[model samples]
Target: MAEVNFCLGPHVGLRPAVPGIKRAPDPPESYSALELQVAEPPVQQLEVISGVESVQLPCRTTAELHDVVKVEWTDSGDRKVHVHSCVPEEPEDQNQVYRDRTEMREDPLRTGDLSLTLRFPTVRDNRTYTCSVYSRAGRPRVETRVELQVRAQQVEVDSGAESVQLPFETTADLPEDTLVVWWCDEPEPAKKVHEHGTESDQHEVYRGRTRMREDPLNTGIFTLTLNRPTVRDAGTYACRVYGAGLIFLREKTFQLTVKGVSVLLLCAPTAAAVSLNVSPNLQQFFSDDSVSLSCVVGAQAGGQAVKRTAGGQTDLCGSGFGTFDGSSCTVSGLSPSDSGVYWCEAACEQMSQQVNISVCPRNDFARCPFILEIPALPVTAGSEVTLRCRNKDGSTHAVYFFRNGVHIRDTTMQRVKVEEFSVSEVQQSDEGLYWCSTDLLGPSHRSWLSVRAPPAPPPPPSVSLVRLICLLVVVCLFCICTVLMVLMCCSRKTGNKSPVAMEMTQCFGEYDDIAAGISTEHDF
Candidate 1:
């Protein structure tokens, strides 16, 4: 079965089976200590996938709102989504498209939950919806805005996985004459991945590899399973549902990625002070493609020399590495040995930051019509990353980008060369199986982007408290020993002394005798 996820908070790591837009919680009631005054309402965004059945746009207030207040939800375009009041309900006031699809709780004003429930939401429903609470006297009281995004369904899988499920389900019973069709864009024309009725028209490559639920008509779970998927199987897949007389009901798009050898990369601090730029700035390239490398020095001096380190050897731009005019290095007919880190060195031994260029072993461009450009190494998080849907002949075509089986970006304006899609401030969620395509140029091979956290700094030197205590004990013992030795020496010197001159000891009477005894003991 196709997995469904609803995330209205912080998201990290892998993308869900289907990804939704970002959302934030409602702002707290700002008029808490005020005397029944309204607070400036802040806008919050909520994300939900259209195929995920339903979603909630939350709006709540702690203030004592009036019981007879009216609650209404409308889009930024002034389209009404829902309305409720103390008067008779007018369902006709809502937009025709949202007439039966929106819902609100009974006496929503009394409970202070003015949230709106949008069902079976699709791309057409993506908009900023405002929730307003009006006083009984037609004065504004509390207003909360919610921006809801309804994204397409997506699914991703490893190339060697046993099976992958593409989800499509609904609560409303489909018409008895409903027809389901599944197709993927691959091999020049669209590949017929599966159909509900018959297997005779199935493609040879997908004959025994596709299946669906048996009681799809009754259960409404029409998820498709592709068995033993391969790398070439990565592309955009669509599931179309039809009603009686072949009337189109709905269509869901899936960006499927059969990941091959994945690249996990992390960047390091710049070795030098120069910046390296690659023309057409692709992360990965096939062997024998021409590339222009420029080492830009912030100082911008005219006579500075540029250098590169690749294939285990450092080559000065003026040498066989490429034609170099001090600042730029242009290499034609790149090879596997040319895949290495490139950087610039200054006259005073300062090194600039290095850039890595990865060259895949297989030249799928030599066989296929196009190949996606990606880094062979893991990308450092928060850096800009560019993905190019490069044609074999470098002709410009309408290029599309898909991450983990979901369409993300497309360059349709061919007025200029728009085959490249650059992702700025790359995040971990942006990491996935990415492939590109064009109307004339065939689909590019899938490239898995891996965003890695920066390497942690080395810990400071540790001092041991136990060792410190031991040193203190040793110092005290040494001081005590020195004091005792001095005392003992003084006592021994007095003990070894002759009391006094025997003649003087006589002390010429009784006074002399007491003085002699005291002098022997006290050693004065």
Candidate 2:
């Protein structure tokens, strides 16, 4: 029964039930307001799938087109993708021509995942390629780009006069259709003295000095060696290739220099014998008359002396008298003019010695004479001749005497006293030559003396008168006798001498008295 029961004053008690919407349970307190939280997928990373970082290839090769190509692709997005294909094609979509020959494969794309696979590989297929992928979540498609290269074997050389090294490398991915050509630059003007590769292939200068280093198979490196280097082998060398209607080349250059070796000389003194000292008291001579000189070497070993001349050429003068061991020499003849420059020289092994000579004159008593003066003396019989002798300057103490040139005695007496040297009792034997000499220690002169007799009184005038008278008488007689003899001789011969005889007889008596007068005078 639907009985209405009055409950609390608000309404009668009648419950309506619903199956799904019974007043929804009050929302939980924790979720009273809207709070949205979104979840994100892991970010993708980029990676390298190709082995090469960068590449250089010959332009002449076409064979790269079909070579088994390797391509790399990476996922760098916030989501995963499934790779569909990596396609290689010409820039103008020319890949269509080789569609049937193309092949590709890829690895699953996860976070940081990258991978590659070969297409239908052949050398002729070398070209740029592309990688494509799609996301499973209906995301945008992902794609990556790649380049295919074609290459020929390349070699480069650096040549020096002494040696050469050829640098070479091969590409594993080179197209089968590529064509390679080997070449070298034009050689210099120098003669080919050496060859590295072979006489017909590679050559260098300096004969018989070539050496080469080549790896087994000659794939990567080749070098040429030489013994001696020269200036001629400097230039550029190259390797070239021709294919695909194009030319490719590689080259290198070398520089060089050369060197050599040399010698020199030197010299010393100007003149010959050099003067050193002057003797006989040089100082006593004037400056113009004094002397001195010396000799020396201007340069030591490896040198020569200068030639000197006074009027004409002369031999080189050396100190033959005072040479010491041939190294040092001295000379002792000096003149006032010799006081100038002088020099001496030694062998290459010895050093040079030089000196200047100075000459001054001095007064030397030991070399010159000292003179003395003597006074004259007068003496009579039994008297002495005292001769005073002294030096010119009167400074000398000791005195000496000489007779003629002979030495007599030496004394300190200034005045010579002699009591004897006279004729005693007036004897005639005492008269002779005599002289006095004085000593001045050197040369001395002598004084001369002459002895004479006193004159006799004139004959008495009275005696003279008588003698005169008698002399007259004798003269007359002598004349008479002479006449007589003459007359007698004439009478005997021819009786014609009367006048002559008379004259003779007249002179005879006078002649007799004249003879007696002469006898009387002799006696007197």
Clashing pairs in 1: 255-405, 256-405, 264-378, 265-378, 271-351, 272-351, 272-352, 273-352, 283-374, 284-374
Tens-digit lDDT track of model 2 for 151-186: 322322222122344443444344333433323233
Candidate of highest lDDT: 1
lDDT of 1 by residue, 77-134 (tens): 8988888764444345878767667898765655767788876676667888888766
Q: Which ten residues in a row have the lowest lDDT in candidate 1?
A: 6-15
lDDT of each: 0.65, 0.32
Q: Candidate 1: which stretches are off by over 4 Å?
A: 1-38, 62-69, 85-91, 135-141, 150-154, 160-163, 168-175, 179-195, 198-210, 227-232, 235-254, 262-524
* Candidate 1 displacement at residue 183 in angstroms: 6.1
C-alpha TM-scores of all predictions:
0.37, 0.18
Candidate 2, superposed: residue stretches over 4 Å from native: 1-161, 167-182, 185-211, 218-221, 224-524
